[model samples]
Target: MVKLSLCAIVKDEEACIGRCLDSVKEVVDEIVILDTGSRDRTVEIARDYGAQIEHYQWNDDFAAARNAALQYVTGDWVLVLDADEILHPEIVPQLQEAIASDRHLAINLVRQEIGAKQSPYSLVSRLFRPLPGIQFSRPYHALIDDSVTEFMAQQPDRWDIGYLSSVAIVHDGYRPEAIAARDKLSRIRKAMERYLSEHPDDAYTCSKLGALYVQNGEIEAGLKLLRKGLKQEKHLDRLLRYELHYHAGIALSKQQKVGKAKSHYEAAIALNILPALKIGAYNNLGNLYMQTGDLTGAIAAYERVWQIDPNLPIAHFNLGLALKEKGKLNEAIAAYHHAIELDPTYAEAYQNIAVILLKNGKVFESLDHFRKAIALYERRDSPAGSELRSTLKEMGFKI
Candidate 1:
C-alpha cells in the first residue's frame, strides 16, 4: 500500500480552499498546507479538513515556498495541487494505481483549464516519488520538476516520467470572475515589470509581458515590447515565439497595420504552435484577406482552418461568408449548414441561410427559418432580431 501526500501553498484563498480540499480528501493519506501569510479563513478551513498547516514567510519566491512544503510530505508519493483547482473524482483510481507502481519515478497529470482545449498542453508534472534530490526552482511560475530532470540526467534509466490518460484536474484559477475578484491582471503587469527589469534578455518573459500589455488595452506598448522581443527570436522557445508573433499580430490589426499584421499571423502559423492557436491564426489571416478584398486569399486561408478543424463553428461561418461573396451559392449554403450543425442555436447562421433561401425563391422554407431565428433572438431581446423582423414585416411577409 503506497501512501500519497497532498501538498499545497496558499494565501487568502478563503473562497476556494474548502472546495479544493473536499474534492481530494477521500484519496490522500495526508494533507499539508504551507500558508504564506493568509489573512483570511484559509487556515481555519484547511484545519477542518485535518490538514497540517505551517506558516512560511512570504519571500516573493514560489519555488522556496513549494520546496518548504516538500519537507513535510511523509508519504511514498506526493501530489501537488493549488487552492483554485480540484482533483477530478474520475481520476482517483488512476492516481492510486500510479503510486502503487514501483516502476514509475514521476507522473505527468493532465490539467484541463475550463473553456480551453488541450493542445500542446505540457503535462504538468504534479505527481512524483519523494526522492532526496528532487526539489523545485524558479521564483515565479516555479518549475516543479526541475530537480527531477537534473537527477535523471545522470541515470537515464531512472527517468520513468510519463503521462496518465485516466486522471485530469480541473483548474479554475484563470476564470474571469476569479481574475476580477483578485485584480489578477493588475498583479500580472506588476510582476512582469519586476521580472523584465531583472531579466531583460529573457525573451519568453518579454513575450508574456508584451501579451499582458495587449490584454490590458495598452496596444502601442504591447506592440513595442513584442517587436523588441521578436528581435531576440533566437533566445525564444518555439511556443513563446509563436505567442509573441500572435500577440503582435493582434495589436497590429487593432492599429490598422494590416500588411504587418498578416505577416505576423503567417509567421505564427509557420512556427507550428498549438493546434487551437494555429487555427486562430489562419482564421485571422482569412478575415484579413476578406477585409482587404482578396477573396481568393481569404478562401485559401479559411480552407486551411477547415482542413485543420472542421468542428469549429467560426471557421465554417467565415467560410460561408467568403463563399457567398464569391457567388458560390450552393457552397455558401453548405458552409452555413456546417456552422449550424456545430452550433444548433446560432441565430446569425440561421438568419443568413434564410436570407439566401428567400433570394433563391424558396419562400415557405425560408420563412420558417426566419421565424426560428426571430424566435430565438426575440427570446434574448437581441437588436439584430428586431431589425430582421422589421425588414420581414416591410417586405409584406406575415410573421
Candidate 2:
C-alpha cells in the first residue's frame, strides 16, 4: 500500500480546523500543516492532533502556500485537503485502495459545494503521487502543473489517472453562514487586485473581478466590469456569459433599471441549460415581474422553474406567493403544499401557507400551521420566527 501524506495550509482556522483533521486522521500515514501567520490557536490545535506543523509567511499566492505544504510530504502519495473539508467515511477506504493500485498516478475526487444547491456536486484532483517534478500551478485557481501531463505523455503506458465516484470530500467550507461569503469575497478581492495588475486586458479576469464586486455589494462597479468583460469575450464562454447576464440583471433590477434587467434575464434563459444559472435567472425575472405589478408574468416565470425542477422549494414557495397575489387561492395553496413537501423544515413556506389559510377564513388550519412553524423556527432560533409569532397572535392565535 502506498503511504499517504495528508497536506493542508491554514491560517486562523481554529473554528473548523479540528473537524477537518478528525475526519482524515485515521486514513493518512502522516499529517502536515503549513500555517501562514495564524494569530489564533490554529497551530496549537493542529499540534494536538500530532500533525507536523511548519510556518510559512503569507505571499499572496495560494500555489506558493500549497507548494510549501507539499515539501513536507514523506509519504508515497499526497492528498490535498482544506482546513474546512472532510473526507466522508465511506470515501476513505476507496481513497486508500486507489492509491495502493500501481495503475493509478492520480485520483480525481468530488468536492461537494454545500448550500449552493439543494444537492451540489463538483470534481477536482485531490489525490496524486508526490513524485519528483510534480508541482502545482496558477496563483489563484491553482491547477496541477503541466509536468504531470508531460510525464503521462512520455510514458504512454501510464493510462492510470482515474476519477473515483465513491470518493468525495464533504466540504463544510461554505457553511454556518458567518464566514463563507465573507471569506470568498476576501479571497476574490485579493485575487482581483493581483490579476488585474498583471493582465489588464484579460476579459476573464475582468469578469471574475466583476463577480467579486457583485458579491461584495458593489453592484454598480460589478455591472460595469461585467459589461466590459462581456464585450471582450463576446460569446466564447456561454456559461460565463449566462452568469454575467444573470448578475447584471440582478444589479440592474436593484438599480430600478427594470426594462434592461428584463432583457438580460430573457437573453440568459434563451441561451442554454445551465440549471443553477437558469433557475436564478427565472427566479429573478419572477421577482422583477412581481415588483412591476405583473403578477401573471411572475407566475409564468415561477411556473417555468417548477417545470425545470419540481423539488426546488424556493421556486415553489415563490410561485405560490405570486399566485396568491393574483387571487388564485386554490393553486397558491397547492403550490405551498408542494413546497412544504419538498422541504418539511422550511418555516417560511409553512408561515405563508398559514397566511393563505387565514386569508381564506380557515382560521383553525392557519392556527395549526402557524404553531408548527413557530415550533420549527424556535428550535433553530430563527429571527423570522419572532415575526411569525407576532403575526399569529394578531390573527387571534392563543400562543
> By TM-score, who's the top model here?
2
Q: Give the alpha carbon lDDT tens digit for every residue of 1-399 in model 1.
A: 888899999999999999999988988999999999999999999999999999899877777899999999999999899999899899887777777777788887867565332121234678888789888765565655658767888888755776676436878877666778888777667766887788886676677788788877899888888988999888665666887887888889888899999999999889854454476677888889999999999999888887876776777888899999999988998999998898787788888889899999999999999998998898877887888889999999988
Give all candidates' CA lDDT scores: 0.82, 0.79
Report, for all candidates in order, the number of backbone clashes: 0, 0
Candidate 2, 1-399: lDDT as tens digits: 568899999988998899999998888899999999999999999999999999999888887888888999999989899888888888876777778788887887867666654224445677898877777754665656355777688787964677677437878765547456446757757876687788776565666677678767899888888788778656445655776687778778878999999999898888854354477788889999999999989999999888877767878899999999999889888998898898898787788888888888898898888888888899888887788778656866776
- Candidate 2 matches the true fold with a TM-score of 0.71
Candidate 2 stretches with Cα past 4 Å from truth are 1-4, 26-29, 39-41, 47-50, 74-77, 90-110, 115-167, 175-177, 180-188, 231-246, 256-345, 374-398
RMSD of 2: 5.1
